[model samples]
Target chain A: MAARGKVYLIGAGPGAQDLITLRGARLLAQADVVLHDALVTDEMLELCPRAEKILVGKRCGQLSTAQQFINKQMIDNALKFPLVVRLKGGDPMLFGRADEELRALEEAGIEVEVVPGITTALAAAAASKQPLTKRGVARSVAFFTSSTAPEHAEHDAIPDTDTLVQYMGGREAIATAERLLAQGRHADTPVVVIENCSRPDQHIRRLTIASLAQGLGAAHGPVLVMLGDAMKTRAHQHNDEAQLPSAVQQLSA
Target chain B: MAARGKVYLIGAGPGAQDLITLRGARLLAQADVVLHDALVTDEMLELCPRAEKILVGKRCGQLSTAQQFINKQMIDNALKFPLVVRLKGGDPMLFGRADEELRALEEAGIEVEVVPGITTALAAAAASKQPLTKRGVARSVAFFTSSTAPEHAEHDAIPDTDTLVQYMGGREAIATAERLLAQGRHADTPVVVIENCSRPDQHIRRLTIASLAQGLGAAHGPVLVMLGDAMKTRAHQHNDEAQLPSAVQQLSA
Candidate 1:
């Protein structure tokens, strides 16, 4: 019997190659066959030059059908390769449909382990020099999404949180804002829209809940919208900041 | 006039040296001085062997006096050193008191920037093969703490969230559970307690809101408690699993 292969579900972090963990980078470098998502960076792929890189990413709107196919391909790869890696955009456990994959791999009698990576909201906070939590101001944070598998997407009530970061929220900002307002979020709640967080081309747009509810123009990069009082400090402070240091300059350069 | 120094507030990540980002590690290596917390690992300090390392951490019960002192020290260091790194335990933006430091640095006309790191909850999820968010099961997640500064610590209401993760929750598990229960969290809500997450000595414990409210034993290491229905799947699945692979053995090795 060929040795039963094990699969590693890895988090690729947000955009930057340097954001990936040393363990994750090491695994990618030595992976027998690596299956990556649509958002995995090319710099990360360069580290895995020796591995067979396969793209199994589901673009927006590609839902359960692609997910089921990815699950099947994962099982097949685990049986053939001693070390198989299924790399996802953020922390595998968060909205990456990892439970389905984990169940499939475990039911097939394959060993599995997950490697965590930095998620995008935190990356957005770092890039903007803001925090998701603050003393006495904003003590808790929520990460949610207005966007879901198209089949399951609906107008769900936005839960109450001190700091709320919504993934894939750009297109639905108007609806999300309406839901939040209906759910009792303050009309003046601070809102920040971050595009391509951590990348050199990242953009930060600040607005109030009312303004965001009115909606804005379309964006090109991956979008995240943060809503809460914790963001108020950043919004107010960014206005007075005039000069960027050499490092930050290079970041936006 | 001598140029003022810049402070880089970098998150060292959840106890693993390798989990620290490439950008974070690079900043550490080049930092003129490094001030790390008690929760920061020694392996992380090794990365900055050439820099002067300062231990300005305040253990549990060490009050706001030390925090004020830390703020003063940070400002003083910025005046002398060209590059000062304030290495925090997790993402500085989350429960890390970064706002006070940012304000102090900015007021003193010194430059500052924050680098994000993987937080403990995400690390715990990765280590336990669980996730902070799921599609139908958990559409939202929250991060909070009961162990605030003594002055700020009170019986505050737990924010309504699908999933909740608490830092320094070991000593306050009973109170936290009671608070959660009072705040409308279900008595049967699943709970997972992770100790010394992402380190070799890490331990994972499972309980329910009711059992957790009854109390658990003290831990020698830092503790994190995760609560949610999203965790229900993992809690059920772990009951029957007994076999450990060689790879897992190496994890304990």
Candidate 2:
């Protein structure tokens, strides 16, 4: 019998291919099989061409693989392959349903290791030149998502923290902004909506609670909403001219 | 005159040399000068052997480079070198004093870019096999630190979130636990203390809010405290044996 193979549950990081950790990249290169989420891009998969690729895609509002099926696939693959990888789009511990997968793997007696990756909140902050935590302004940050699985109940309540980051937040920005307003946050509390963070076509829009409540135009790709007083652009930032668009332009040139 | 150098404010990640992002590592390799924080390990510095390294050490209770001096150094290097890297310990956006440095660089007319890294909270969660956010049990997570600068007033109030991860929390974990207990959190709320996360000598201790209030034993390196129901190990995890030590032993063997 073949030696019991191990599984690596890795976070692929925000959209950029190179945003992945060197450790994760090295594991991907050595994996005999790779199961990746839907949000993971083709460029990222290029790092593991030798592996048998499986798409266990899970995205909001789209038909995708079941969590249980994904778990079973991981167990089956671990038995067959020397190395197996389950790659999630962002940090696996946050909103990634890592608990269910971990339990399943443990019950099957398959050794599993989790490799950390940069979460989108941090990536969005980097792209927009906004620090989620600003001294004397915002000290605590809460990351939450409005989307829930069919088996789970949806929560309309907002997180009670200094800064709030909402994943899959494109469609709910208006409602979230209104709720923040009702919660007594200042009308001018800064809000940043990032679409396709870290991707080549990433777009960042800077607004305030009041303006975001008016509405966000159509957003393509994954969207993240960051709202708080800490997100206000520095007094000397010269507006959004120097943010994502300029960075992309400079890098491309 | 030398071309104006752009400064990349990169997060060195949570101690492990391979944990740095591919983008960050690539930039470090091409950097002309690297100004790294005290928490950055020497193994990570080996990635950029060709670059001139400056240690802007800033550990708690230790004499270190002033924020202003560090900012000036980045600006000066940007004017002289083609690539300047201001390497930080974790994600630069979270509790990393990035605002002051960003402002200073902007004031000096130097371009700056922020690269996200795996924060200690996420790494600790992964190392302990505890998800910071769990379905139903935890919908939100907060990261904070009790170690405040001497010039700033400390906040006695704990953050209101489903899960809380405290950075530089070893010395004050007992005080923090007491505050949490007083704030109506259940005495049995699970807590995990991780020291030297992601490093070879990393250690993880699991306890409860009541037990944590009794005081944590002496810790040898940078410490992180994670407290919440979501941090509780799964019932099937068979105690802490499957957590870190066994993994280390297996890998070493």
Candidate 3:
């Protein structure tokens, strides 16, 4: 049956179009249909000029295309064209809901391949010039999603570690920070909130864990929150004030 | 005084040339001198054909350029070339010793920028079509290094919850598995070990946490081990016998 169409789930990386992997970029360029997320930038879309582009991004309480609908669209498009690109933000495997898409594609007898990209955590860490793991600072690195199911969140407790990165934490940034503090993470632990990371319009604010709950009200767009001693170490080495804009500075003050 | 040259710490992703980000790929092409690790593939190096390629990779117990020597070479190169790319395998901020190199570059009054790439953890997980974080399965994820200071290993303990991804666990794979089991991880916890991930020579095997200690004797080259319920969920969804090669059959047997 037309050799069974193949679907490529590709991570677009953080905002910078060049941050996308060569494989992902090539797939976008060659795909018959490209389904992308809201976080993807125009620069990334330009790489897939020939493909039919469809925006399937979801924002908080927005009239977003449901995940099931996107999966169906991929299957439907693949039937017509052998190549389909399910473009996602950051690394497709990292909190990108790739598993659900994979299962949907597989059930439809569509072949699937995944190409990894730089996740926002790493990109944000890079933009801040912070090593997530250092010799004397952070020995362990933890990743969590602020949008986690309540049951999973309750069962999967945050460990008392020196490095913690929270993904998709824009709306619930304050609540996530508060929960960590309640879980015994030090209040003064250094925290970095990066918005639109790796993009030209990227915003980064360095603050303490205790201040993060209050400071986050000033942030815009999907935020990535990095906490622990590693943040403090990076802040100590770099100029924190230089990175913050006047608006954020006023909020922090 | 001439404007101080800059060093770009770029991640080459996992072995695959196309897997390197477009930005990272561009940087590699423009690099005046490229210092790469042993794990970096020949394909990735081709992007920087005009640049002077230096091998600063660390091999276990083998005579190689010391970190100190490599640091010195970067400083010396910065004096001549306006741009230098310190290419590393996977994400430079993950297990990479970027901090040490950054310190060396900064101390010499050279500017440094880090460009993150897809780490093996994400690459391996993508290859297996498994999400590192799944709803109700894995709420948190942790990346641990088997290559660590003995003092740190002795001082801090690995977390029991969350999905644990271990890097460079080739020789110590069994011991690390044993330690996880000892630390209250379920003996039957699912584990996926990928060797040479994202490369054309990539090899993957699945086993239970209890079986990992015995199964690891056959693991080859810079293995990445992922353990937790998310893996178990993936194992259950796929036909284990059909998906896994017979090479791993002995472990379960």
Candidate 4:
């Protein structure tokens, strides 16, 4: 009998197909089957054309694959295939509910390797041409999201760090800004919102905490919110692309 | 005369050569001159062997390149070459003095692009097979370094976040543990120290905050310290590699 196939949990990186690590790209090409997240772009899936593709992520309204079912699929695929790939958007270590999947696979006694990908926060920082940490101005950076796990009760306390990057900052973007403001964060703290980062239609909105608390138009793609004084654009640098309006037209409720 | 060369600030992810982003590798191959940090591995430099390579990073006990001199080198090279690459260890935007270089380049009207790489924190998490953020236990993660800028007066406050990853945790690793313990963090909080993460000689040390406070043998390579409840190894998971002692022999001072 063939030994249980090893599973590779590879990060697809932020939106751009080529942003993935070379190791991730190589493993994807060799995979016998790939179970990917909703945010993994179709272009990324094309990297492994020979492999069977499964979408396990829950889109905004789409019926999402149950965690248990996805775990079962990985185990079942490992039994039948030589290489199994569990592809997640962004680095698998953060906000992806990777702990559950890793625990499930561990119980099954399947060998697994995690290939890191560029997380959205870093990509968002790159897109805005702003470093998340600046010399004396900022020294620490925190990555958090308002989205809570089904089993966990949400906490109101925000992380006290030098810089903040909120993933999945859709409806909660304004709420986050308000809470930070209430926590005495500067109202004029710079905020950079990047939607569909690294994609062809990527859009960047540069505003302030006070302006963000007032409101930001609805976004169609995944949104990442970065707030801190370090995000302030340097004087005399002419970055016109970030000043332009969002390419994705906002739909009214 | 050739148009002024655009500068690309590419991240050489972790310590591994294959960990670099595809975009970074592609640009690196097309570079006419590459100025890289001291931490970038020789294998990564092989990607741009055709291009002139310059070591511009500060190594301990060695005469280091001045920030202004490095900035001037990039500008001078950009004026002569079609493609100039300023390669940095890990992500350029994290602890690297990228802002100074970016400012200098911008002032000279040179086009610059930042390509994100997998930061050492994420790679350390991957090396240890521990997720930085968990559903209920850890909802936020902070990345900081003890090293400060030359001009900045150091502050004593540690970020108040669920999970903390400290870069360049050389002599300060124990000091960080002591500080965290003093700040009311549980002494039993799990800590994972990764030395030369993602490299062939990579080493992982797993212990508690109290144990870390006691002492850790000196590390020759870059050391990253991760501390949080989320770093706890799952009960059923039998990860033996992490249990193994340091791969690199510790030198007694």
| By lDDT: ranked, best first | 2, 4, 1, 3
Query: Which of candidates 2 and 3 is the stronger one according to lDDT?
Result: 2
Model 1 Cα lDDT, one tens digit per residue, A1-253: 3587879998888887777877788778778989988888777788788889999866855677888888888889888888899998878877777888887777777778888888998888877777888888888888888545554556556666689999888888888888788888889988888887766567788899999989867888789999898887642254322332235444324
| Greater-DockQ candidate between 1 and 2 | 2
lDDT of 4 by residue, A1-253 (tens): 3588878888889977778988888888878999997899988898899899999866644323577788999999998887899999999998877788889888888877777899999888877888999877888899987645423424557788888998888678677887898889999999999898877678888999999987777888999999898899997565645432121111100
**In model 4, which regions exceed 4 Å deviation?**
A60-65, A149-154, A240-253, B61-65, B147-155, B240-253
True contacts kept of each: 0.69, 0.72, 0.65, 0.75
Q: CAPRI band of model 1?
A: medium
| CA error at residue A29 for candidate 3, angstroms | 0.7
User: lDDT for every model?
Assistant: 0.80, 0.84, 0.77, 0.82
Clash total of candidate 2? 0
Q: What is the TM-score of chain B alone in each candidate?
A: 0.88, 0.90, 0.88, 0.90
Q: Among all windows of ten consecutive residues in candidate 3 chain B, which has the lowest summed lDDT? A: B244-253
- In terms of DockQ, which candidate is strongest? 2
Q: List candidate 3 stretches off by more than 4 Å.
A: A61-65, A147-156, A233-253, B61-65, B151-155, B233-253
Residue A47 error, candidate 1, Å: 1.9
Tell me the RMSD of model 4 versus the true structure: 5.6
Which residue runs of candidate 1 sit more than 4 Å off their true CA positions? Answer: A147-155, A234-253, B147-155, B234-253
**What does the lDDT come to for candidate 3?**
0.77
How does model 2 fare in lDDT? 0.84
| Tens digits of per-residue lDDT for model 3, B46-121 | 9998899998857655422477888999999998998899999999988787778887887777777788888999
